[model samples]
Target chain A: EAEVAQSPRYKITEKSQAVAFWCDPISGHATLYWYRQILGQGPELLVQFQDESVVDDSQLPKDRFSAERLKGVDSTLKIQPAELGDSAMYLCASSFGFNYGYTFGSGTRLTVV
Target chain B: EDKVVQSPLSLVVHEGDTVTLNCSYEVTNFRSLLWYKQEKKAPTFLFMLTSSGIEKKSGRLSSILDKKELSSILNITATQTGDSAIYLCAGATAGTALIFGKGTTLSVSS
Candidate 1:
C-alpha cells in the first residue's frame, strides 16, 4: 500500500536558525495536512491543503512558519528564526478527501536548543 | 471550541487480559470518529465510526461510537505484548479538520 513519506526523521538546530520539513502524500490523495505534536499531547493542526491551494492555516504562525504544496502532491514547511518552543514532532498526513480518513507519516522530530 | 478527551491516560495489563479505552468529544459539526494505534512512531489507522451505536471490529480490536453522547470506546481482548501502544481517538467535523485527544497509553505485559 502507498504510504505518506517524510524526510529527515530527526533534526536538531539552534534557536534563531531556519529549518524545513518535507512530505509526500499517498498516491492520488488530494487532501494534505500538517500537524505539530508535543510530548505527552495530541497532534494539533497547523495547516491544511486541498489540491494545490490552501484551505486553512489559522493555527500556523504566519510570522515565522510557512507551508506550500505547489503541484498538489508534495509539500514543504519552513520555519525561520526558530524558537525553542518550536521543538516538537512535525507530522504529515493525507486523505483521499474530506470524507475519508487519513494516513500519517512517521514524522520529523525537531529539536531547537 | 472543539475538543477531544480520552480517559485513563495510561494503562497496564497482562497478556490475555482485556482493556477498554475511552474517548469523548465536543464539536460544532461532528462528522466521524476515528481510532489509531501508535507504537513509538506514526499512528496507524484502526477504525472509523460515523454513526451511532454501530460497532466496527478488526481482529482483537473493536470500537463503538455513541453520537448522541459524543463518546466512543475501543476494546482490546486477549491482549498480547504486541498490543502495547498508545491509542488515540480523533474527531473530525464536517468540512473541517480533525481534533485529536491526548491518547491512552496501554502497556500489556507478559
Candidate 2:
C-alpha cells in the first residue's frame, strides 16, 4: 500500500522558536492537504495544494505559518515564533483525484512549550 | 461557509452490540460523503458515498447517504474492542476542499 509519509513523528519546541514539518504524498496524487488537529477536535484544514499551486489557504495563519509544495509532490509546513496554543497534531493527506476519499499520514505531533 | 456536523460526540457499547453514527452537512456543490476510522495514529478510509439510496458496506460496517436531507449514517454491527476509536465524516465539494465533522468517539468494551 502506498502511504503518505511524514517526518519528525514528534517535535518539542520552546515558545517563539521555529518548527518545520515535512510530508510526502502518495505518488501520482495531485491533491495534498495540511490539517491541524487538537486533542479532542477533528482535523482542521490549514492549506490545500494542487500541482504546485495553492488552491485554498483561507484558514492558514499567514503571519506565523507558511506551507509550500514546490514541486507539487512533497510539502513543508513551517511555523515561526510558535506559540503554546500552536501545539497539536499536523496531518497530511492526499487523494489521486479531487472529490475522492483521502489517505492520511501518521502525522507529526508538535508540542510548544 | 461549508459545514459538517456529527452527533453523539461519544458512544460506549459492549461486544456484539450494534451502533449507529450520524453526520449532517451543508456544503456548496456537494460531491460526496466519506467516513474514516481513526485509531491512535492516522485515519483509515472506510467508505465513500456519492449517490443517495445506495448503501456501501464492508464487513461489519455499512453506510448510507441521503442527498435529500444532506445527511449520512454509519452502522457497525457485532462490534469489538478494536472498534473503539474516533469515526470521522467529511463532506467533499466540487472544486473545493473537504469539510469535516467533529467525529464520534466509540468505545466498544469486551
Candidate 3:
C-alpha cells in the first residue's frame, strides 16, 4: 500500500527560530492537507492544496507560517520565529479527490523550547 | 463554524471487553464521516461512512453513520492491549477539508 511520506520525525528548536517540515503525498493524489495536532486536542487544518494551488488557508497563520507545493507533488511547511505554543505534531494527508479517503503520513513532532 | 465532537473523552477496558466510541458532527453540508486510530504518530484510517443504516465492519471493529442524527459510532469487540490509542472522528462537507473532533482516548489493559 502506498503511503504519504514525511521527513524529520522529530524536531526540537528554541523559540523564535525557524522550522520547516516536508511531506510527500501518495503518488497521483491531487489534494494535499497539512494539519497541526496539539497534545490533547484534535488535529486542526492549517492549509489545503489542490495540484500545487492553495485551496484553503483560512486557518493558517500567514504572518509566521508559509507552505508551498510548487510542482503539485511534494510540499513544505515553514514556521518562522516559532513560538513555544507552536509545539505539536504536524501531519500531512492526501487524496485522489475531494470525496476520496485520505492517507496520512507519520507526521513530524515539533518541540519548541 | 462547522465542527465534530466525540464523547467519553477517555475509556478504560480490559481484554475481551467490547468498547463503543461516539462521534457527532455539525456541518453545513455533510459529505462523509471517517474514523481513525492514532497511536503515537499519524492516524490510520479505520472506516469511511457515507451512507446511513449501512454498517461498515473490519475484523473486530465496526462503524455506523446516521445522517439524520448527525452522529456515528465505532465499536471494537474483543479488545486487546494493542487497542490502546486515541480514536479520532472527522467529518467532511462537499468540496471542503475534514474537521476533526477532540478524539477519545481508549486504554485497553490486559
Candidate 4:
C-alpha cells in the first residue's frame, strides 16, 4: 500500500525559532491535509489543499503559520517564531477525492522549548 | 461550527473481550464518517461510513453509521493486547476538512 511521506520524524526547537515540515502525498491523490494533534486530543485540521490551491485554512493561525503546495504534489508547512504552545504532532494526510478514506503519514512530532 | 464527539474517553478490557466505541457529530453537509487507530505516531485508517443502515466490517472489527441520529459506532470483538490504541472518529464535510473527536483510548490486556 502506498503511504504519505513526512519528514523530520522528531524536532525540538527553541521558542522564537523557525521550523518547517514537509509532506509528500501518495501518487495520484489530489487532496492533501495538514493537522495538528495535541496530547490527549484528536487531530485538528490546520489547512487543506486541493491540487495546488488552498481549499480551506480557517483554523490555521495565519500570523505565524503558512503552507504551500507549489506543484500540487508535495507540501511544506512552516511556523515562524515557534511558541511553546505550538508543540504537537503534525500529521499529513491525502485522499483521492471527497469522502474518500484518507491515508496519514507517520507525522512530525514537534517540541518547542 | 462542525464538531465530532466521542464517549468513554478511556476503556480497559481483558483479552477476548468485546468493546464498542461511540461517536456523534454535528457537521454541516456531512459527507462521511471515518475511524482510525493511533498507536504512538499517526492514526491509521480503519473504516469509512457513508451510508446509513450499512455496516462495514473487517476481520474482528465492524462499524455502523446512523445518519438519522448523526452517530456511529465501532465494535471490536475478541480484542487482544495489540488492539490497545487510541481510536479516533472524524466527521467529513462536503467541501471542508475533517473534524475529529477527542478519541477513545482502549487498553486490552492479556
RMSD of 3: 1.1
**lDDT per prediction?**
0.92, 0.92, 0.93, 0.94
| Runs in model 3 lying further than 4 Å from the true structure | none
Candidate 4, residues B1-110, lDDT tens digits: the string is 78899989999999999999999999999888999999998899999888653579999999999988999999999999999999999998898478999999999988
State the displacement of the C-alpha of residue A105, model 1, in Å, after optimal TM-score superposition: 0.9
RMSD of 1: 1.1
What TM-score does each of the candidates earn? 0.97, 0.97, 0.97, 0.98
Looking at candidate 1, what is the lDDT of residue A93? 96
At residue B39, what lDDT does model 4 achieve? 100
- State in Å the error of residue B69, model 4: 1.2
Candidate 4: clashing pairs of residues: none
Q: Residue-wise lDDT of candidate 1 within A2-68, one digit each (tens)?
A: 8899988999999999999999999999899999999888889999999999999999999999999
Worst 10-residue lDDT window for candidate 3 chain B reads: B46-55
Candidate 2 structure lDDT: 0.92
Q: Is candidate 3 or candidate 4 better by DockQ?
A: 4
Tens digit per residue, CA lDDT, model 3, A1-113: 89999998999999999999999999999999999999999999999999989999999999999999999999999999899999999999999975577899999999999
DockQ of each: 0.80, 0.75, 0.83, 0.85
